[model samples]
Target: MPRSQAETPENETNSHAQKALSLDPWEAAYLRFETPEEEIQKFIGRLNRLGAPQWPRDAEIVELFCGRGNGLIALQRLGFTRIEGVDLSPRLLAQFKGSAKCTVADCRRLPFTDRSKDILIVQGGLHHLPALPGDLDQTFSEMQRALRKDGRVMFVEPWRTPFLTFVHLISEIPAVRRISRKMDAFASMTEYEIRTYEQWLGQPELIKKIARAHFVPVHEHVGWGKWNFVGTPR
Candidate 1:
């Protein structure tokens, strides 16, 4: 996405915020390597592991930071008919192939009415937010506002696990990058997200604390460089 011309200090701030919150050009380009079929199956596996099979198929669902709508397609395949997606990147949203409604909007400021949504899902997105507790708090608050009393929220994000630490340590080695195609790709992706990724990984405990403050936990798993959390509005 092109940055808006900064006519004033406020515009500069908005530009910075947009940079921090949305995928950069290179990151968006990397997404093209991900096939729709593969992404759908990958999301299906994640949802099943997160207990999505128990969720009401008819419930209204919105996915924040939904890039290319693979997760939305996965939801449809799982029998969900009422689904929508919100993201800041029009370029990524344009790649969506499914029937779900897609909206270009910031996740911290959702467009849905109060208590109107039945579920919200976010995958691999929150780490992009630069502001730590404040941005996280605002996003969760917005989530609560959009969710019904019984509504649930689910997310999968990077965590600072031992394996991840080790991976990052060795990912810097020239030999590893040249020898492993997967590692090479991973390194390229992480290079684009290094700033925000470091910020988010440094506060894993705080992230969990903030999440728990807004929602009653239904399920949570932290390991293998990923944090998967499921909860209902408090």
Candidate 2:
């Protein structure tokens, strides 16, 4: 019998996902193998083109699911001040102590008041959302609610086309599949499921949801390096 979406085995106890975040294996592999100089330059170049620094230098910026403070650290170097980083990993947050104010929490239930931020940045966070069978729309609404009017949310997502192809190739690799299964087994919440979590993820529908939340797209750029989706609160 063919597997049904409703019958798909849950990997809420995956240990690898519990170790940090439920990272796209492709992105995780690239992060593990590629040089930071190459990745950072590629990221910054695209953001620079998109006017990612449009938020005032003194404005409060929040980096949701900011792992190890990489984005926050880099943004600080670029003149951003009063930055806050939030994530679920205590180990990751602990390493960021003194570098920035790091909060360990879930993005789905952000602990900030409405209209609390000037610029909200979410890098590879939303894909982690639809992984489970819970309230995705509500979570997006919460994110929208947290942003002040005129606030912007920037996301770097794997283009859906490429993500599908990547998943197909990786599923053929035995070792990778084995490791993925083990990780899925150790996950504690549906949030950590790696396979179904990654399948068919994209930004267009998400952009539409953002629109419903009273935001409008400022840009959608598919560059040689990465795809960026930027939206401003209405």
Candidate 2 residue runs with Cα over 4 Å from true position: 1-39, 130-134, 162-193, 199-207, 210-214, 223-227
lDDT of 2 by residue, 8-74 (tens): 5554435445543655444344234324454456556655766766668887788887765677766
Runs of candidate 1 with Cα error greater than 4 angstroms are 1-24, 175-181
Per-residue C-alpha lDDT of model 1 across residues 57-107, encoded as one tens digit per residue: 899999999977899999999999999999887878976878999999999
Clashes of each: 0, 11
Candidate 2 matches the true fold with a TM-score of 0.67
Scored by lDDT, model 2 comes in at 0.64
**RMSD (CA, angstroms), candidate 1:** 8.9
lDDT per model vs. reference: 0.88, 0.64
TM-score of 1: 0.85
